[model samples]
Target chain A: MSSLKTPSTFIEGPTRLGKAELAALVAADIPDGAFVNLGIGQPTLVSNYLAPDSGVTLHTENGMLGMGPEAHGDDVDPDLINAGKIPVTELPGASYFHHADSFAMMRGGHLDICVLGAYQVSARGDLANWHTGEPGAIPAVGGAMDLAIGAKDTFVMMTLQTREGQSKLVEACTYPLTGVGCVSRIYTDVAVFLIDRDGDHGGGGDGSVVVRETHGVTFEELEGLVPVPLRRP
Target chain B: MVTITQSALDAVADIPDGATVLIGGFGPAGQPVELIEALVETGTRDLTVVNNNAGNGDVGLAALIGAGRVRKVICSFPRQHDSHQFDAKYRAGEIELELVPQGNLAERIRAAGAGIGAFFTPTGYGTPLAEGKEVREIDGRHYVLELPIRADYALVKAHRADGVGNLTYRKTARNFGPIMAAAATTTIVQVHEVVPTGAMDPEVVVTPGIYVDRVVVVPTAATPRPEEDQ
Candidate 1:
C-alpha cells in the first residue's frame, strides 16, 4: 500500500478514505437496476466495488451497454474497450450499437447515473471538470458535457481538497464550466455532499451545498475547511 | 453487383482534391490505416477530414496531416500526448481545426445519416462552444442548435464483410465506422476478409451493403510497400 500524505490544513483534519474506499462508498449507493455510466479515470474504479449481483448495467459512450468489470490477462480483447480505451468484459445481456446511438442514450436522458471526476463542483452543483482554463491547457472536452446534462443524476468522485489544500467544493468555480448546475451528489475522499438549487449561500442565488456524510470530520470542521459556507443536510 | 477493389490505392484513386472525407476511428481503433496510406499515396490534397479524435502517433491521419495533405480537421480530442504533429501544425497555423464536443460530433454525423436537418442539444450551451450559435430554451433549459456533418467520402475499417459489402465490426473497434459509413456519399471499407454474400448472419451486420460503395480486403500484417515493390 502507498503511504498517505498528511494534509496541510487541520480544519477538517486528514482524510483516511483512499480511492478504493471512496469508490466502495459510491458503489454501495448505486441502487439495483440502475443504468450507470462511469467516466474515465477514478470514476471507473466504482465498477470494481459493486456487488456481483448489484444488477447495475454499465454503459460506455463508445458504443456498449451492459458492460461488466475490467478484464484481466487472457480475457482482455483489444477491440473490446471502454470510452477510456481500457479493456472491459461484457455482461450476459451486453449489446453493442453505433457510436451515435450510444451518445443518443447519453444525451437523451436514458442513463440513470453518470459518475465523473471533477476539478471543481460549485455550491449550486455546477461542474467544471473538462478544462482548468490554465495557460497552454489542451482543453479536450470528450463526452463530459453530454453526460453531465443528460444523466438523470450526475455524481462526482474526487478529493474534497486539492493537493495545495484548496477546497474543490467552492462557492464559484474558477475553472471553465462543463455543465451548469448538473451535479446532484459529490463523493469525495473526506465526505459526501448533496448539492441542490436551494439558494442558501447567496452567490447570485446559484444554490446551496450541504454535507451528507463524512469520513472522520465533523460538519463544523468541514465548513471551516471550505472557503465557502456549507450547511448540514 | 459487388464493387471489390483490387487494392487500397485503386479504391481511393477517385477521391479528388479538396474532398470532404470522414475517416472513422477513435484514436487508432477502427481506423482504415491502409486506406489512409493509399490516400497519401494517391496524393490527394486540400482535404477536410473528420473523425472523433485526432490521429495518434505519426501514422494514419497524423501522417496525412504531416504529409501536408489536410487543410482542416474536425474532431473532438485533437491533442493527445502523441499528437505532436497536429499540435505543431495547428500552432503554426499550417492547418485549421474545428473542435467539436465528442457527443456533438457523433450526433452531427449521425444526423446526416438519419436525414435530420438540425437538432438542439444542451451539450455546448453556456460555453465557448455555443458561441455565435442559435440558442433556445425548452422547458426552462438551454440548448444549442447543431447541424448535420456530411462528407463526400468516408473511409472505415471493419472486422469482416460479405461479398456484397455487408459489414460487421469487431468489439469496441466499431467506434465511428458505422456512423461514418452512413454519413458519407461514398463509403469505402477495409476488411480482413470478404465471404460470400449470404455468409454473414443478417442479425450481426452493423452496416448494411447499401451504405458501402467499395470493399477492399486488407491483408493481415501488410505494410506500405515501396513504389519499386508495387
Candidate 2:
C-alpha cells in the first residue's frame, strides 16, 4: 500500500502570467502538422502564440481552415472570423468552405487537438461549457457537446476558481454534461493537470494524459518539453 | 411543487406575423406539442419554422402546418404521415423548405450559442449545400465555414421542472431540447409536469434551469404518432 501512494506533481508558475503565457502552455504541447480547433475564450489565444514555424493547421467551426493567429490591424480580413465572431487572419495555405463540412470534420474525428473554454472540469476530464444561466445571458450551449465528443483530444482552459470562489475542478460536474468521459487535460491559472483515469475510484481506462503546473512560463517555452523526473505522487 | 399557470401563455401572445421560430424536435420524437398548439391556437402566421423534421400531419408540430401557421420550414426530414400539412405546403412551395443535414442543423444551432461568427466543414462540401459559400482547404482537406443560425424564439418540451425552471427530459426525448434551449433569444418550455426542487434525480436532469426563461405546465395528451407508426 505504501508503494502504491504517489506524490502529487505540481508545475509552478512564476508569480503571475497573463493570458498569452497561459495559451503558449497549451500551444506548446501540440505537435507539428496537427489539425486543431481553437474554441472561444482562452482557447483562441493559442493561435497567436503557436510557433510561427510549426506546420500546425487551425480549423474554426465557422468554416475557415488553416487559420493563422490574429492578424495585424492592417492584415485583418473582413470576411475571416472564428466561431466567436472575432476577426482572424488566415495562413498562406488557408481555405474556406461551407460550414457543414467543418462540423463533419469535427464529428468525423479528423482533428488532432481542440482547445476549448470550460465552465467546469470533472476529475475524470468531463467538460461542461454550455450554460451557467448567468443573469440576462442568452441560454445557449453552442457546439460544446460535439466538440467535447468529436475532437480527438479535448483540452480545457479555465480559471482554477470561479468568481464566487467555487472550484471549477470538482469530483463531478453540477452543470449539464457536454460529453461523457471526453476531457483530456486542464490548463488553469494556478496549475495544469492531466485528468487521470487510473485512480482507485475504478473508472474506465488508464490515466495517460499528463498535467503540469505552468508556474508562469509561456507555452512556447514548455512545448516539446516534459518534466525530466515525473513524480507520480 | 412547481405550478404552471395560464399566465405563461402571455409570453407568446403578442408574437407578430412572419416570425422565424426555432422549434425543438426531430419530428414527434421530441417536439413540444403544447407550445405548437398554443402558437396554432393563437393564430400566428407566416412563420418560417426551423426544426429537425415536421411532425406527423395531425399531431405534434404538424398541428401548426394543419392550421396554415407555418409559412416555411427549414429542417432535415418531414414526418411521413399521409395527412401531414407541412409536406403538402412544402411540395406546393406554399412553404419554403431549406433542408439541412441533421448534424448540420445541430451544429448551426450550437455555433450560434457559442457566439461563433462562422465556421467551415466538409459535410456539405461540393454539394448544393456548398453553393454561394466560400471554400477552403487545409492540409489537403477541403472545408467550408458556415455562419451561425440564431432564432428570435425557441420553444421546447421538458418532462419535469422546478420553480427555478431547471428541467429534465424522460429519455431519448432529451434530444434537441438542450440545443434549441441554447440558440434562442427567448426560450420558453412547455412541461408535462412541474416538480419541487430536489425531487428530480440530479443524474437524470438534462437541461438546467439557467438556460430556461419561462415554462408552462399542461397535462400532456396522448403521445404523438411515431414515424415508425406512419
Candidate 3:
C-alpha cells in the first residue's frame, strides 16, 4: 500500500498479504449457512475464495439471491446483469424479485453479513464510502448506506492507508458518513480489527478496538501508525 | 384493459413532452431499449426521468439523456465507468439530478405504487443525506421521512406478456419493472413474446395486466425493422 515504506530495523522480514491472500483469509473466516452480499468492487473477489460447497448465498442488489460467478461466452445474458452492470450467471436455488423485495432483504436484517470497499472507517465503526465530499464531485450512494446499516454485521475491505500514507482507519471520517457505528470488522492488507461494540465506552470515542491479527508490521509499529489505540483480542 | 401495440413508436406515441416518466432498469438489464429509442425519435424533451443508474454506454437511457430529452434525472447512482453521456451533461449543468439512496429510491417508488403517502427509513440517519429532512426517533432509532415518487408514465422491458398484458421478467431484469408499472399513470412495456389469454399461469405473473396499459413486442438481437418511410 502507498509504496511500502522502508521498514525500520526493529522487525525482521515483515511481509504483507496480497489481495488474493487477504480475500482467502476473509473467505475462510465466513461461517457456512450465512447469507452474504458483497459490494461491487474489490469485495467481489471474495467469491473466488469461497468454496463451491459452501452454503453462503450471494445476494446482488439488482434483484436476485444465489448469484453465481461472472458469465462466460455462451452464458452471457444482457438481461442477467448484476448491480455493477456486468453480465453474470444464476446458480441453483436462485430467485428473482422486484427492487423493493431485493432491498427489503437487506434493510430488514435478513442478510447476515456484507463486505464493502471503503475509503475510511472510523475506530468507532463509522463508515464513509458513498461520497468523498470534494468540490463538484458527483456523489453516488447506490446501496452502500442501506447495506452498511441493514446487514447484521458490516465488514469493510480496504488498505489500511491511502496512497499518501495516511491511515484510513482514523479517529473520525472527514468524508460524508454512510452509517454510524455500523462496521463490525475491517479486513485489510496488514491487520484485522474487531470492534468491541459491547464495551461501555459510550460517547467517549474510546472504542477499545482489538487487533485480532497483524501482518508485515509489529503490534507496536501498527499502533504508532494508527491514530487510535489497539489491544490484543 | 391493456392495448396490444404493434410497434414501439405507436406504444409510446401518447406520452406528452415534459411528462414525468419512470424508466425501469438497473443499467441495461430491464431497460426498454426500443421504446426509449422510439421516444428519442419522437423528439420528446423536457422530461423528468427516474431510474437506478443515469445511463450506461450509448444506448437506451444514455441515448435519451444525450438527446437532451431529459430535463432532470432522479436516480441512485448516476456515475459509472461507461456513464460518460450523463457525466458530461451533469458537469455542464445541463441536466438536474436528485440522487437518492438505492433502497430509498426503490421503496419510494414502491410506496407510490402501493398508495402509501410517506414512510420513514433509517438508511441515511445521521448522514448528510438526512440533512433538513423530518427526523423522528422510533423505538430509540432515528428515521427520516421519505415521500413516494410518482410519475405520469413508466416504460419497462420484460421477458413475456400475455394477451391481456400480464407480465413476467427474466432473472435479475425484474427489478423496478413491477413497481414502476404500478407507480405511473400509464405503463408501457416491450417484451420478446406475447402469449394468448389464460396461457400465463396466474401464480406466475409478476405484474398483472391491470398495472400494464400497453404491451409491444420487440424481439431482441437483429430483427429487421421496416423503413420509416412517410
Candidate number with greatest TM-score? 3
The best candidate by DockQ is: 3
**Poorest 10 consecutive residues by lDDT, candidate 1 chain B:** B221-230
Ordered list by TM-score, greatest first: 3, 1, 2
What tier of docking accuracy does candidate 3 attain? acceptable
TM-score of chain B of each: 0.94, 0.89, 0.95
Kindly list the per-residue Cα lDDT of model 3 for residues B1-230, writing each as its tens digit: 89997799998888898999999988777888889889999999999999998887788888999999999999989887778899999999999999899999999999999999999998999899889999999898788999999999999988999998999998887999999999999999999999999999999999999999999988762211111110
**What are the candidates' individual DockQ scores?**
0.39, 0.03, 0.47
Task: For residues A1-233, write the lDDT of model 2, one tens digit per residue.
Answer: 00112225545567555688779878888888888988776688888778877899988765567876654577644344556545567668876543345666788888888888888877667777765655533233445555666777888888767888677877677876655567767777756766654453222344333445555544444432322112222
lDDT, candidate 3, residue A92?
89
lDDT of each: 0.82, 0.66, 0.85
Compared with the real two-chain complex, what DockQ does model 2 have? 0.03
- By lDDT, the better pick of 2 and 3 is 3
TM-score, candidate 3, is: 0.93
lDDT of 3: 0.85
Clashing pairs in 3: none
| Clashing residue pairs for model 1 | A79-B172
